[model samples]
Each structure stands twice: as structure tokens, then as C-alpha cells.
Target chain A: MRYAFFPGCSLETTAWDFDRSVRAVCRTLGITLEDIPDWVCCGSTPAHTSNASLAVALPVMTLQKAKHMGCPVMTACASCYSRLRTANHKVCSDPDERQRAERVTGKPYDGSVEVRHVVDVLVNDFGLDNIRARVKRSLSGVRVASYYGCLLTRPPEIVAFDNPEHPSCMDDLFKAAGAEAVEWPYRTECCGAGLSMTEPDAVNRLGHKLVSMARQAGADCIAVACPLCQLNLDLRQADAAKAYGAVLPTPVLYVTQLLGLALGLSVGELGFNALTVSADSVLQRCEMVVSAGRGGRP
Target chain B: MENRLESTGTSFLDEVQRRSGTPISACFQCHKCSTGCPIGPEMDVLSSQIMRLIHLGEEKEVLESQGIWMCASCEACSTRCPMGIDIAGVMDTLRMMAVERKVAPPDARAKHFAHSFLQSVRHHGRVYEMGMLVAYKFRSRDFFTDMDKGPKMLMKKKLAFLPIRSGAASEVKEVFKRVEEEKEQ
Candidate 1:
């Protein structure tokens, strides 16, 4: 299957690995991801607070570009998916708003483009059975906490793919990738985004609680959808530890990275170097690689 | 604390009912939102206590509490709510209200940063990352903390030097003006 790919700004920088893994996995699955040209930021968190209309317009422009390509659009970032889906829903449901959106873009958006989250495309379009067939390495002892974060599921009507409260999209993906997905209470908690710089204490406090809870739930690593969540949980986790005077180490990974590993891609190919907390121990336990080898070998 | 009460006329109970849509009168002192709140453990005032304060018309306490600012806006309480109320929206409304009333949390950094972000967007028609960060530090008075990372970001070419202007900057301005006019009304 071929789809238009929108890798939002974060994926280009901090979550570069997510972009790499997404491309690698698409290749393995025989799917074509045509990059949307001249795409702007999806207006992640700022657009929603600053101007709701711009947030809607930003994604609509990308979707229109994708429609020109004549394919459904898929986003690697959860925030991108949420914003895109929100724009699509609003344009489809409200006629006046849709007209205004079209006037702004100089193009008609009749909700022709389908915006699917990476997890949704993998689980629903690719199917678990097909993904399982591609898994060369079985992640037997690796325990993962599938953290969905807020944007992917909240305001459920906009992102109608899963149940907002108890989402299992990541869990199903993890299992298909040969990893054990753990259940945790703070899976849907906010990572104190955008406020990480402004209100570091609040973010640290919140981040510590989430990491600690995931650890207490017996997770080896936390898997996430949003880049902001990954930043807070992995990057700021050290600062969060300083606040409580207790060092807690918990690595976070994108769901696509795990799938890439299962699909026989190497660590460098999956952007493992971008993560703050080292996943060496977790990877060691998975035994995809022998002590001497760099790449995963069956 | 008492002085904070004289500023806003909306009573806590009224605001809570308006924002949450749950009858604050029927709370029965239950702590469901608190218990189910994943971030409640880190909050200064538990979610249940915040709800109770709102029920009692303690607008000062409810609005001033760090609980409002600390909320992750995750909607856990709203989902687990026995009365099917939107507790997260209540917190968001309170936060927005607090900002409007200038009763902002002691840590005004987030508000200042948000304002800085908007200023850059309004002027350039898009967010100018370096300019926004510089404005944020100048406004918040914490310039040196991440000062080093700025150059690294620029060096890597990750930070956009030019603002990506929107097609409808003037229209967006009109929308903001309309909101301001509505506020005046």
C-alpha cells in the first residue's frame, strides 16, 4: 500500500530515530510512504493554544497536498495525527469552517484525505498476522509499558481510532513485534509538555511520577507515540530525579523503533542513539544480537 | 488569600458547575477524580479536595491552588467520573480564568512563555524559535539555564532561522481582535 507521509518537526530533530524506523518498517512491509512536499509544522501544542484556526489550517494544507498525490496521509507523530484528524473532522462536520479553511489555503478540502496514525495504519491496514510473519527476532523477556500519551486518544471524537481511557493499540503492536506489553496507570498521563522549559518543577514532578509508576508496574522500558512525551519521560527524567533526590532509570522508545527491531533492522537504523536513557540492557535481554555482533541475527 | 476573593465575582460553585457540568452539590465528599487522577499524587492539593473546595464556593483556594496548574489535562477524572463530568475541563477553565484575572500561579513562567510564543507568531506570522526563546528568557528572567543549547540547536540547523508565515495572518489577527471585542463586551 502507498500513503503520503507527514513527519512533523519533532521527528526531524529529537525523534529522528522514529522517522528512520518508520521508513525502515515501511520498506519491510512493502509499503510506499511518499513524503508530503513543503509541509509546515503540524502546530503541535502551540497552535491549539495560540490560534485554533491556524492549527486546523496547517494540517489541512498538508492533507490537500497529500490529496493531490492521491493517497491517504499517515503521521508518525501522535500530535500531528491529532491535529490533522481534528482539522479533517472540523472541515467535514462544519461547512462554514470548511469554506473558511478553503479560502485560507486557496484550495478546496472536502475531507478527501484520510489521516491515519502510524499505529492505526500498522494495526488495521498492515494487520498483526502480516507483521508477525516479518518478525525474525522474538522479544521473549522484554517487558514494555505501552504509553499512549494524551493527544493520540483524548478528545476521543477527533481521534476516533481507539478507546481514550484504555487504549490498547500500542499493546497490540508491541505483542505483534514480539515484546511483552505491561499495564500501567500513568500510561495516559501528561508529560508536562511545552511547560518543560517554563515550569520545569511541575514537569519534573509529573515526569518522576510517571517514570516511577511505570517502573513500579514492572516495565523495562516505556513505549510512546508523541515526541513531546518521549522528551519529558526520557530527556527531563534526570532533572525530575534531582527534585526527589532519587535516581530512577527508565528508557523510552517509539513503538515504531520496537517494530523495526523486530523486523530485523539494526539499532543505528532505528535511531536508538537519539534516546537519552540507554536501551542497551533491554536490547541485551531481547537477545536479538549476540555479545559480539552489532546487528540482530536470527 | 482573602484579597484574591474580592477580585473575581464568579463563585467557586458556579464556576465549577459551569466548567465541569457535574453538580458540585452532589459531590458527597467522594474522591473519585482524585483517586483516578494519575498525576494527583504529585499535585499540592488532591483532585478530590479541589472539587470539594469548588463545591464550598472557596473560589480563592480553588483558583490559587497549584492543583489547577499541575493538572496534565489528561481527562482521567473526566473519564472515571461517576457523574460523567468533565473535571479536566474544569481545571482548564480555572487555569484560563486564573490567567485572565491575573491571579496567575506564582510561577508565571509558563504564561510568560506562552505570551512570548504568541508575540512571535503574531509578528512574524509563525513561530520564530530563537526569537521566541530569547523573548521568553527576557520576560521570565531565566536566560542562562538553556543558553548553551541554543547555539547547538542553531549549529545543527534544527532551529528555523526564518519564520514560516501563514497565508492568513491578517485573518488570524481579526479572529484575535474578535475575541478581544467579545471579552470587552
Candidate 2:
């Protein structure tokens, strides 16, 4: 399968590892992902929160670029997927808003391009059976809490991807990769997002709740589908804990990284080293760790 | 807790409904949105209150409130609303109207950051985090907002020193100019 990739803004910097690992995993899975030339920002929370016209206009411009490629545009960032999908929904469904967006961007956007998240690409496109066939090492006995955060499934009419309240796409991927997916209540909860920067205290309180919940639920690690959730739960974990004298030691891994591990991709290839809380202990516990350059099956 | 009620005319509700494309008149103050809102405590005026205020035809106070600026837009309100109100979209429309009408915003830093973010996107066709930071710091005059965060991000290579342009930024700028000329209600 082939797709036009839209890496969005955060993937270029804060979430660079997500970008690399996504590319590496896609290549290994025989999925062709070509980049859209000169794609602009998806406007993220800033645009939609500021102005409706600008929000719709910004994403429509990029989707129009992908439309010419005649392929589905795969997005790794949850925020981008939400914004892009919302733009597509608005332009096609609301005639008057579509007219305003067309007038603003000075181009006709029929909102016909297909926008798919990489999580959807992996679960829906690749299928569990095909992915199970590629597992070189089993992630058995390792319990995982699949953190969907928001955007991946929210305002259901806009995302239309999975069960908004209880999504299982990431859980199914974890299971097929040989790990047990833990059932948790905060799977679809907000991770404080940009509020992490603007309102650190609120973010810490919320993040602490999520981290503490996952740990309490008996999961050794948390698997996230959004980069923001990964960063907040893993990177700024200290900030989350220092809030209420809590201990948050769970390792947060991208869903792709876990699958990449099962596929026997190297530690470096999966970018595990970049995560703040190292994934080494969990990998070792699950017996998925490989000695460098040995093509390990242990 | 009298609201100093204003006249219930003036097309404010219609304008908000038109801009957001949501059924503003359908909101009946179930307060389900307020209960589900995670940031409702942080907001001066809660999510349900904003809808209620608009319904009461109280535009001035609602537009000047900090609730719109503080909202995380997590969609808890939008998702749980009994009337299927796109409550978050109404927040966005209020923010836009607050800007275009030149009203004094309760949160100046957020407004400044929004402009800086758009400026960076307009120039580079993608976000240049460092450039956007500089633009924000210059405008807000608050260089120490995240005093050590920038350098730490730089050490981790999460913040670039130079711009990462798409080489076709002219196309993005064209879109920006056109959006500026948009005269839609």
C-alpha cells in the first residue's frame, strides 16, 4: 500500500523519533509512504482556537496538495489528523463554510482527499494476521495500557475512526504483537496538550492522574498513539509526579515502537533511546531485547 | 449574582451560530458539558455558562471573559452535550469575534502567541519553533516565560536554531493574504 505522508509540525522537532520510527516501520512492512512536497502547517490548536476561517483554510490548503497525489495522506500526529479530518468534514458537509474557506484560501477545495492516521494504517490496512506473521520476538507477559489520549477518537462525527469512548485499535496491535493490553478507563482522556506549556500545574495534575492510574492498573508500560501523550507521560513525567508527591515510573512507548520490537527491528531503529524513561527494562522483562548486530530472536 | 442583564436583540447569537455552524439556539443549559469539562475549574466562566451567556444575548461580558482563552478544547463539552452542540466551536467563534471587533482580551499572552505562531507558519510554510519563540518573546516582552526550557530543548535538538522552510513559502503567504481579505460574516 502507498500513501502521501503528512508529518505535521511537532514531528519535525519535538517528535522527530516518531517520524523516523514511522518511516522505518512502514518500509519494513512494505508500505510506501511518499512525502507531500511543500506541505504547510495543519494550524493545530492555535488556528481553530483563534479563528474558524483560518483553521479551516490552513488544513484545506494542505489536503488540496495531497488530493493531487491521488492517494490517502497518512498522518502520525493525532492533532494533525483531527484538524485535517475536521477540515474535510466541514468543507464537504457545510456549503456556506466551504464557500468561506474557498474564498479565504483562494482555491477550490472539494475536501475529497483521504486522511488516515498511521495507527489506522497499521491496524486496518496491515491487519493483525499479517502483522502477527512478522513477529520475530514475542512481547509476552508484558502488560500494556494503550493510551489513545484525545483526537485519535473524539467528537466522533469528525474523527470517525474508532470507538470514541473505548478505542481498541492500539490494544489489538499490542495483543497481535504478543503483549496483553490492559483495560483502563483513562484511555481516551485528555493529556493536557498545549496546556502542558501554558498551564503546567493543570497539566501535571492531569498527567499525574493518568500515570498513576496506569500504574495502579498493573501495566508495566503505557503504549501511546499520539506524540503529545508520549511526551507528556514520558518526557515530562517528573513534572507530573512532583505535583502531588506521586511516583510515576511506567515507560511510555509509541505503538509503532512496540510493533517494531516484535518485528525484530534494532533498538536504534525503533528510537527507544530517545524516550526519557528508557524502554530497556520492559524489553528485557518481555525478553524482546536483542544484542546489537546479532539479528536476535531472543 | 445578578448579571446586569442586557437587551436580548443585536444578532449576537445569530452571528455566533453562523460563524460556528452549530445550533446555538438549541442549547438548553443541561450543564452536562460543565460537569464533563476538565478545565472548567480553571476557566473564569465555565463551558455551559458561555453557551448560556450567548443565549441570554450577553455578548460583551462573554467576549471579554478569559474562559475562551483558558479552554483546552479537549472536546469533552462538545462530545457530551445533550443537544449535540459543537460547544468548542462556539468558543472558537467567540475568540475570532473578540479579535475582529478589537475587544480587550482577558489573556493578552495567548493572543500574542497565536499571532506569533501564525506569523511563523505564514513565512516558512511550516513552523519554525525558534523563530516563533523569538517573535513571541519580542511581542509579549516576556523573554523569561520559559527561561531555561528553550536551551534545554535546543540541547535535545527539539528546537532548531534556523528556519525549516518548505521552499514554497510564497504559496503559504498567498493563502494568508487571501484569508486576510475574506469578508465573510
Candidate 3:
């Protein structure tokens, strides 16, 4: 399968590991991704909060470019996916908004190009059975908490992704990779997103709640699909523990990173060491379980 | 944390309904939005209370309160609201209106952050994280915030030293210009 990939701004810098692991995993699955030419920023929260017209126009410009690729556009960042989908939804449903967007973007957009999140592409398009077939190593003993965080599933009408309140796509993907997917309640909770800069205190508190919930559910590591979610839950985890009292440190891994481990990709290939919270302990435990000859799930 | 009410007419409600395109009248004080809001504790007013303030025409309270800015736009409230009020979209509308009217938002730094982020996008056609953070520090005049995280981020190679300039930057700038011109009209 081939797709036009829009890796948003975050993937270029802070979430570079996610971008790397996404590419590595897709390659293992025989999926080819071509970068959309001159794909600009999606105007995430900053643009949408400030100027509605600019927000729509920014993503529409990228969509117009992706149309030339003659395939569906895939985004790894949840915020970018949301922005792209929102723009398409508005331009297609409202003629007045479509006119304004065309005037601002200087391109005629019929919203024909399809936008899909990487997680959706994996579970639905590629099929979990095919993913299971490609696994070279089994993560039998590792328990993963699937963190959806918001934008991936919420505002269901626009995103139309998974279940808004309780999503299972990430968990299903992990299960297919032979890891035990733990049930967690805070999967769809807000991670204080853009407020990570403005209101650090609030974000710390929210992150603490999420980590504590994940620990309570007995997850060895938290798997995320969004860059902001991973940053807050992993990078800010220590500070959150200090703020809300001590909880066992739970490492945060991108969904693709965990899948890469099961697919026999090297740590360097998946950028595992780039994480603030170390995944070494959990990975070692998995190795022990495999060496003990209990690697296969029943 | 409020001043005297300027007007209690339907003007504020009408404006919010028109701008957000939500059915404000359908919100029957359910408080479901408030129950689902993760950042409700940090907000000066709850989500349902913000809707009530708009209905009562308390524009000053709704706009100036930190509630609008505190909204993460998670859409939890919008999804769970039985009346389908689009609470998150209304919060977005209120935030933009607050900026346009020059209201002293309870969280001024939030507004500054948005401006700094947009400036980076306007210049580079994408967000240069370091550049945007620097611009935000200059605008907010609080440089020491998150300073310690920088060294670690740089060590991890998470912080890029320079931004790769996008070739379509000029075209992106033109789009921003057209949007501004349309707003002026």
C-alpha cells in the first residue's frame, strides 16, 4: 500500500522518534509513504483558537497538495489529523465556508482527498491479522495501557475515528502484537494539550492523574498515538510524580514503537532510547519472559 | 471574581449562538459538560456556568474568566451533551472574541503563547519549536519557565538547532495575508 504522509510540525522536532518508528513499522508491513510536497503546518490549537479562517486555510493548502499524490493522506499526529479532518468536514458541508477557504487558500478544494490517522490505517486498512503474521518477537508478558488522549476520537462527527468515549483500536493493535492490553479509564481524557506551555501546573496535575490511572490498571507501559500525549505523560512524568505524590514510573511508548519491538525492529531504529522515561526495565522483563519459554500468548 | 453586569439581555447569547453556530437555547443547564471537563478544577467558571453566563448576557464574565482559556478543546463536553450544544466550539468562539475585544483574560500568557506559535508558523510555514518558544518567552517576559527541560531535550536531540525552511513559505504567507484582508472587509 502507498500513501501521502503529512508528518506535521511536531514530528520534525520533539516527536521525531514517533516519526521514525512510524516509518520503520510501515516499512516492515510493506506500506510505502511519500511525503506530501511542501506540506505546511496544520495550525493545530494555536491557529484554531486565534483565527478560524487561517486554521481552515492552512490544512486546506496541505490537502490541495496531497490531492496531486492521487492517494489518501495519512497523518501520525492526532492534532494534525483533527485539523485536516475538520477542514475537510467544513469545506464539504458548508458552501459559504468552502468559498472563504478557497479564496484564502487560492485553490479549489472539493474535499475529495481522504485523511486517515496512522492508527486507523494500521488496524482497519492493513488488518490486525496481517500485523500478527509479521511479528518476529512476542511481547507476551508486557501489559500496555492504550492512551487515546483527545482529538483522536472525540468530537466524533468530525473525526469519525474510533469510539469517542472508549476507543479500542490501539488496544486491538497491541493485542495483535501479542502484548496484553490493559483496561484503563482515562484513555480519552485531556492531557492539557497546548496549555503545556501556558499552564504547566494544570498540565502536571492532569498528567499525574493519567499516569496514576494507568498504574492502577497494572500497565507495564503506556502506548500513545499522539505526540502531545506522549510528551506530557512521559517527559513530564517525574514532575507529575513529585506534584501528586509517588507512583511507580510508567514508561510511555508510541503505539508504533511497541509494535516495532514485536516486529523485531532494533531499539535504535525505533528511537527507544530517546524517551525521557526509560523503557529498558519493561523491555528486560519481556526478554526474561521470552527466555523462560512463555513468550506465546494462549 | 466578577464586576457589575453591563446588560442582561439576549445580546450575548445571540452573538454566541451566531458565532459558534451551536444551539445555545437547547442547553438546559445539564452540567454534563462540567462533569466531563478534565480541567474544570483550574477553570474560574465551569463549562455549564459559561453557557449560563452567555444566556444571562454576562459577556464580561464569560470572556474574562479563565474558563474559556482553560478549555482544552477535547470535545468531551460536545460529545456527551445530549442537546448537542458544541460546547468546545463555543469556547473557541469566546476565546477569539475575547482577543478581538481586548478583554483582559485571566490568563494573558495563554494568549501570548498562541500569538508566538502563529508567528512561527507565519514565518517558517511550520512551527519551529525552539523559535516559537523563544518568541513566547519574549512576549510573555517570563524566560525562566521550562528552562531546565531545555538541556535534557537538547541532549536527547529532541530540540533541533535550526529549522528546515519550507519551500512553500511564501505561498503560506500569502494565504495568511488573504485571510487578514477578508477579515478587514
* Candidate topping lDDT: 3
List ranges where model 2 is wrong by over 4 Å. A288-298, B1-9, B104-108, B183-185
DockQ of each: 0.20, 0.61, 0.80
TM-score of candidate 1 to 2 decimals: 0.78
Least well predicted 10-residue stretch by lDDT in candidate 3 chain B: B1-10
Residues A76-149, candidate 3: write the lDDT tens digits: 99999999999999999989889999999888999889999999999999999999999898889889989998
lDDT of 1 by residue, A125-213 (tens): 99999988988887778899999888788767678788887889889988987788888987777787666676667778878888888
What TM-score would chain B of candidate 1 score versus the native chain B?
0.78
Model 3 spans with C-alpha error above 4 angstroms: A288-298, B1-10
Please tell me the TM-score of chain B in candidate 2 relative to the true structure's chain B: 0.89
Question: Where does model 2 sit among the CAPRI classes?
Answer: medium
What is the DockQ ranking, best to worst?
3, 2, 1
Q: What local lDDT does model 3 show for residue A29?
A: 91
* Prediction RMSDs, each to the true structure: 5.5, 3.3, 4.3
The best candidate by DockQ is 3
Which ten-residue region of model 2 chain B has the weakest summed lDDT? B1-10
Residue-level lDDT of model 2, residues B105-134, one tens digit each, is: 744566777888889999898889888888
lDDT of each: 0.73, 0.82, 0.88
